[model samples]
Target: MKALHIITGLGVGGAEQQLRLLLAHLPVDCDVVTLTNPGAVADGLIDDGVRVVHLGMTGNRDLAALPRLVKLIRAGGYDLVHTHLYRACVYGRIAARLAGVKAVVATEHSLGDSQMEGRRLSTGVRALYLASERLGRATVAVSPTVADRLQRWGVPGPRIEIVPNGIDVARFRFDPLLRERTRRRLGLPEGAYVVGGVGRLTAGKRFDVLIRALAELPREYWLLLVGGGAEESVLRRAAHDAGVTDRVLFTGERPGGGLPGADLPSLTAAMDVLCSPCAEEAFGLAVVEAMAAGLPVLYVSCPAVEDLPPSAARGARRVQGGADSFVRALLRVRAEGAGPRSVPDAAHHYCITRSAAQLMDVYTAAVSCTSLGVSSS
Candidate 1:
């Protein structure tokens, strides 16, 4: 079936990258539209021969863009309209209805307990989201954790589908040569313990806790932070204040653009451990990816692993508290020594192929239900 995927922007965040991976595996003709900045992920989509259109949406209240989107959707004659992210969900749903496309679906990729896409869940935001969500046939939550959040936010239980985010598992397999080369490229000593943190460097992510924790570690212990955001300077200042600036390495927004040491898997190969300090997380995708690379992970919260049994991701440990607690955990892990562990079952469970197949079922159900003229109830 012909489907058009709409998202707020095409930045290098988890949601954007997840959409790219999903499109590669879904068995359908699809095009993409980005409402604003067509950044790295947009380029990757184009490189993969996917049609990507920038809607030139100025901001959230860009009502003019709505009619334009409706016109585009109507002209495309798409059978389904799938949206990702918040702005796209709101506008894409209304535009699909105006464009006469009945089969509409959305994926809630980054819905945390109290925040979504790093934005606080204000009363108005909840009301607006619920209003637009009603226009869609189904809303896919990235995890059962997020499905619960959506239901709490007033989305009907039957209308919410749980399609956990997936990853290319084999691509992240631990490689000895890659590990050596990537560590050398990053100027890390062969035996140095690298504490890796991958995610958008936002205040909500609490990357600063890692910086503070780094100060308590030995000089040979290094901190590798992947991804970029508004909090880079804040994190840099924190690193400086902690007197561990020299040991902290920040790779600014690597989108796996074929860079040898910069790509995520290569960086994961070089890491000794992955640490996610964020107390609130939707799915903890990075943690899963790291586990796929056979790296041990420490996190404050990760629904993707927590929702499953302990054996699903044996290498991942959930640590409570802040920098002090992280420092203690780091010390314990250091004493145990760093080595590649067995890739946990959790990594295999979230394989991109499986997610693609599950999403196709969601698409099929939405389309068939819409054809019957049944309310998306």
Candidate 2:
């Protein structure tokens, strides 16, 4: 079926990258529209031969974008309109209905209990979300935790589908040669016990906790932070204050470049272990991807692993209590030494093919329901 995906931005965040990966596996003709910031992922989509349009939306109240979106959707004659991220969902749903497209779907990629997309939820935000959410045939939650959060926000249980964020497992497989080359490229010393953290450098992600934890460890235990955000300077300052600035390495927004250490998989290969100190996570995609690389993961919270049985991800451990807690966990991990890299069952479970197949079912169901003139509610 012909589908159009709308998102607020095409930056190098998890949602944007997830969309790029999903499109490669989904068995349907699809195009993408970014309201603003058609950055790295947009280029990747273009490289993959996907049509991407930038709406040039200036701000949240860019009312002009609504009509342009409606015109695009109506002219494209798409069978389904799928929205991602918050702003896109609100505007996409309204535009889809105006464009005469009833089979709409939205994926709640970054919803937390108290925050969404790193922004605190207000009364008006919740009201607007629920109002627009009613226009869609289904709202996909990236995890059961997010599904529960959607239901609590007044989305009907039946209307919310749990489609976990997926990864290309083979792309993340650990490689010894890659590990050596990536470490050399990053100027990491031999036998360095790297403590890797992958995600946006945001305060909500609590990457500062990793910086603080880095100070307590030995000098050989290097800290490698992947991804970029508004908090980079703040995190750099935190590292400076913690006196681990020299040992802390930041790779600013690597979005699958051609070089060996340029992409996420190769970067993961260079790491000894991965730590995510963020207390709230929708799916903990970084943790799963690290596990796919056969790296043990220490996370403050990860619904993707927590929702499953303990045996699903044996290398993943949940730690609490801030920097001190992380420091303790890292010390324990260092004591145990780096083990053989083995992809966990959790990584295999969230394979991109499985997520694409499940999403196709959602698309088929939405179209079937629409043909019957039945309400998504």
Compared with the true structure, what per-residue lDDT tens digits does model 1 show for residues 1-377?
99999999998898998898888889999999999999999988998889999999999999999999999999999999999999999999999999999999999998887888888899999999999999999999999999998998899999999999898888888888998998999999767889999999999999999999899888888999999999999999999988999999999998852222337999998889999999889999899999999998999999999999998988789999999999999999878976656789999999999999999999999999988998975
TM-score of each: 0.98, 0.98
Name the lDDT value of residue 85 in candidate 1: 95
- lDDT at position 164, candidate 2: 91
lDDT of 2 at 303: 97
Overlapping backbone residue pairs in candidate 1 total 0
Q: In angstroms, what RMSD does candidate 2 have relative to the true structure?
A: 1.5
For model 1, give the 10-residue run with minimal summed lDDT: 254-263
Tens-digit per-residue lDDT, 1-377, candidate 2:
99999999998888998998899889899999999999988988998899999999999999999999999999999999999999999999999999999999999999898899988988999999999999999999999999999999899999999999888888888889988998999999877889999988888999998888888888889999999999999999998898899999999998742212238988999999999888889999899999999999999899999999999998899997999999999999878977889888999999988999999999999999999999876
Q: Which runs of model 2 end up more than 4 angstroms from their true locations?
A: 257-262
lDDT of 2 at 23: 92
